[model samples]
Target: MVISEADHARVTVAVMEAERHTAGEIVTAVAEKSDSYHDAALHWAVLAMLGVPAVLAWRPELAPRIWEGLVESWSPQPAGAPLLVALVGSVLVFLLFRLLFTWQPLRMAMTPGATKTRRVRRQALALFRVGAERRTRGRTGVLIYLSLAEHRAEIIADAAIHDKVPEDVWGEAMAALLGPVRDGRAGDGLVAAIAQVGAVLAEHFPRGENDVNELPDRLIEP
Candidate 1:
């Protein structure tokens, strides 16, 4: 999302240069975030609701006033007063949490890292299939996907590249990307990653005579 025109051009040029020496197709994509994580937000809200009782238990002095506030009883209350107060407290807590989580920073913080990883990988795979898979004649397409909010990246290769290259072989490329990304240099990181990925592709799938570029060499922001 922070990428500018210069950054976009750099990525496109890197991809084109990488493809020149190899028959592999490379697609670069960036997303602000992979998911909204509504489920994580809901879970946080529910936990807040569940915590109300524990909180009230710690501050017993608050219970009587809270109960009186809910029913405004001038007379002795029935046995159900405690239940009413609890319900009211839980609802208030839940609502407060929901409101706070509407702020994206809080919501993202509450989401588990494992959940974000899964969503980011899932989204990258889906995008690669749509934007790169089988689009080239040799089926040597590769995708470099960056999710900014999660600070994560994924590399997806098509049939030919997958058959020739081991999954661990892409670790250097991933590292090249994340190093700069973590430093708030996403564009530079992406360019470095494309070069790394391209080098791997070139090594395994050298370009053939009259090789044609079957895919565009532009960055996709979807």
Candidate 2:
């Protein structure tokens, strides 16, 4: 199909908007569908592929071999270059939707909410119940909750915590929760450990010294 430039632009904008709306859903799907390490490895490979032009600019000799390999690997009676370019472009666009638009929001929206709570329950019922306890931590007393029901595990903390803690801490906490169970009763230590983690997070992302009213009772339902 011959896609016009105007049509392409319009479609791209629409896809981006849809990605913004469903970013969380896509991230959840990716997390559930694949291991984090595997996904990270794929991302690194793509980045490396993206860097090929720059790499070749510095080391031109390697380009001949790379081109030869690509040609050799090309199928017999292969599709025309234009068709191949179109196919590859389409795949990359969809991957951008999956990796950039979808996954970015999922990471940003990693907090306890109705949608996330549902996900946690799906993953582990016992963990969901125990992890649902919201606690005030640190001198500031930020609210943090951990949930484990859905395909992707999550730690939900108050928005206040975002600027305070180093990003790596959050990453570590998530890896811990999502990683394989170390002991037979891995769930046993989760709550206390998460609470302690919350305290540490609070120190960086402190809450108001005064207590705010707990969330409305309606918001508290499982």
Candidate 3:
């Protein structure tokens, strides 16, 4: 999901060309992932731990079988000692499962789709605020944000553009951007989306003689 230097250059060129006919300032950004989702991992670990006791409770024979084995192995130990060992063992199992989910892929897999969507949207908005909103002279700045891990893209337009442009109008550009992403061509996706957005902006905000590049054309990798 990494964006190559060559791809970054191509995206930058697309931004430059797109702005030629539009007063809208486009800013592009890509992030490897929106979040680590440690909380999701922790939740999964807790569920797994809780399931252990639930299973034992549901199948009473299962615990007795384990106790028999422990008795044979530690006959000299106090009866209560085996219970302590079992408790410690359960804790260890929970800890191990929790640690395993710390890996990004495992953690992300356990996360709900809705959660990932929220995180991606949150990240995209943050980028928009920093990179596009409140920066353009005409308040026509737009942000195209992509979160590779979530395979999600967001197109955020500043107040001026959003007021005049129908919300659904951005859907086409977002579709264009996501098409390439779905095909694993992130750079191409961004370039195509930029062109679509430029076309839309050109129609509504035609370039003026005083129009200048108010935003950097480079792709922000956050």
Per-candidate clashes come to 0, 7, 0
Q: What C-alpha lDDT, on a 0 to 100 scale, does residue 43 get in candidate 3?
A: 85
lDDT of 3 by residue, 60-110 (tens): 566656766757864564656545545765787789998899789988877
As a whole number from 0 to 100, the lDDT of residue 191 in candidate 1 is 93
lDDT of candidate 1 vs native? 0.91
The TM-score that candidate 3 achieves is: 0.92
Worst 10 residues of 1 by lDDT: 77-86
lDDT, residue 45, candidate 3:
79
Q: Give me the runs in candidate 1 sitting further than 4 Å from their true place.
A: 54-62, 69-73
Model 2, span 59-160: residue lDDT tens: 755555544556765545343543444445446654664565245335334433564555453444333234322332321222222332233544443333
Question: In candidate 1, what are the lDDT values of residues 83-144, reduced to their tens digit?
Answer: 67778889988999889999997888889999999999999999988888988888999999
- Candidate 2, 49: how far from true, in Å? 34
- For all candidates in order, the CA lDDT equals 0.91, 0.37, 0.88
- Lowest summed-lDDT stretch of 10 residues in model 2? 22-31
